[model samples]
Target chain A: MKARVTVTLKNGVLDPQGKAIEGSLGSLGFEGVEGIRQGKVFDLELADRSEAQAKADIEAMCEQLLANTVIENYSIELL
Target chain B: MKARVTVTLKNGVLDPQGKAIEGSLGSLGFEGVEGIRQGKVFDLELADRSEAQAKADIEAMCEQLLANTVIENYSIELL
Candidate 1:
């Protein structure tokens, strides 16, 4: 089974890296880009686990190490 | 308007960060994690552009700055 986890910054949290990217985009002539936020994606391959079990396991992984709950939110997708 | 870009490493490319992450998951007792690959996501808010134009512009951004075409693949999402 394959799964994907997307971890994104929570609303209102300051994202300097995102700001930097936004600035760079403007400088590179991609005009009218108002805001940019950066996040992390994890693509995982598991060994014959059921989709439900895989989702549960990856959720636990996100809670423990993959995401900082205070500043980020994570979503899991089974593929 | 909003758009998202996901950038992932191309196959056959060595991924030390992904390996480290996988190792960390195992150490933290999340077993059965066979393989892990890491990627990046960019969330953007645009300034009142049409969805079609937004997609085109972000595509350019991805090709020119957000993604390294040589060893990475990028996908754009319109939202």
Candidate 2:
């Protein structure tokens, strides 16, 4: 089975990288880019498991290391 | 309006960060994590525009800056 974890900054958190990218985009002449926030994506290949089991495991993973819960939020998708 | 851009490495490309993350997960006692690949996500706030316009603009952004099409694939979502 395949799983994906998306980790993103919580609302109001400062994102310097996102700012940098936004600036770069503006300088590169890509207009209409009002604001940008950057995040991380983890694509995982897990041993075949039930959706419930996979989601449970991934949630644990996110709590342990995949995401900084204090500043970031994560969502899991199973495929 | 809002938009999202997801950039992921092409298959067969070496991803050291993903490898390190996978190793870390193993060391942390998270089992059944077969393979892990890391990618980037960009969330954007665009001036109110039609979905077609937003998608067209973002596609250009990806082509010129957001993604290295040679080794990465990008998908855009409008919200």
Candidate 3:
């Protein structure tokens, strides 16, 4: 089985990296970009696990390590 | 208009950050996770631009700023 986890900064969190990228884009002549918020995606290969099991495992992973729950939100998709 | 950009490390690229997260997950008692590959997602709000124009602008952003073509791939979706 394959799983994808997307982790994103919560609203009101500052994204310095995204801001930097936006600035770089402006310098490169790309116009009309007002802002950028960057997040993370994790792709995983699982070994014969059921979708429910995988989702549970991934949720645990997110809470434990993949994301800082205080400042980030995560969602998992089984593929 | 709104746009989403997902950036991922190319296959065969080393991801130390992902490895670190996997390790942390294991220590936190999440089992059966073999590997984790991390990527980035960017959400942008555009100022009333056509989809084609936004896609073009985002492509330029990816090439010039959002992704390192040498080691990453990026896809843009207009929403």
TM-score of chain A of each: 0.96, 0.97, 0.96
Query: CA lDDT of A19 in candidate 2?
Result: 95
Question: How many pairs in model 1 have backbone atoms within 3 A of each other, for residues 3 or more apart or on separate chains, i.e. clashes?
Answer: 0
Could you tell me every candidate's TM-score relative to the true structure? Answer: 0.96, 0.96, 0.92
Candidate 2 chain A: minimum summed lDDT over ten consecutive residues — where? Answer: A25-34
Q: Candidate 1, residues A10-77: lDDT per residue as tens digits?
A: 99999999999999998898888889999999999988877788888898899999999999999999
Residue A49 CA displacement from its true place in model 1, Å = 1.7
Q: Which model scores highest in lDDT?
A: 2
- With a 3 Å backbone cut-off (N, CA, C), the pairs that clash in candidate 1 are none
lDDT of 3 by residue, A1-79 (tens): 8898989899999999988877877787777778888899998876778888888888877787788999999988988
The alpha-carbon deviation from the true structure for residue A71 of candidate 1, after best TM-score superposition, in angstroms, is: 0.8
Model 3: lDDT to the true structure: 0.85
DockQ of each: 0.92, 0.88, 0.78
What TM-score does prediction 2 earn?
A: 0.96
Q: What TM-score does chain B alone reach in each candidate, compared with the true chain B?
A: 0.93, 0.97, 0.95
Across residues B1-79, which tens digit of lDDT does each residue of candidate 1 receive?
A: 8888999999998999999999999999888889999999999899887778877888889889999999999999888
Q: Estimate, for each residue in B1-79, the C-alpha lDDT of model 3 and write its tens digit.
A: 7888989999999999988877887788777778888898998877787778778877877887778999999988888
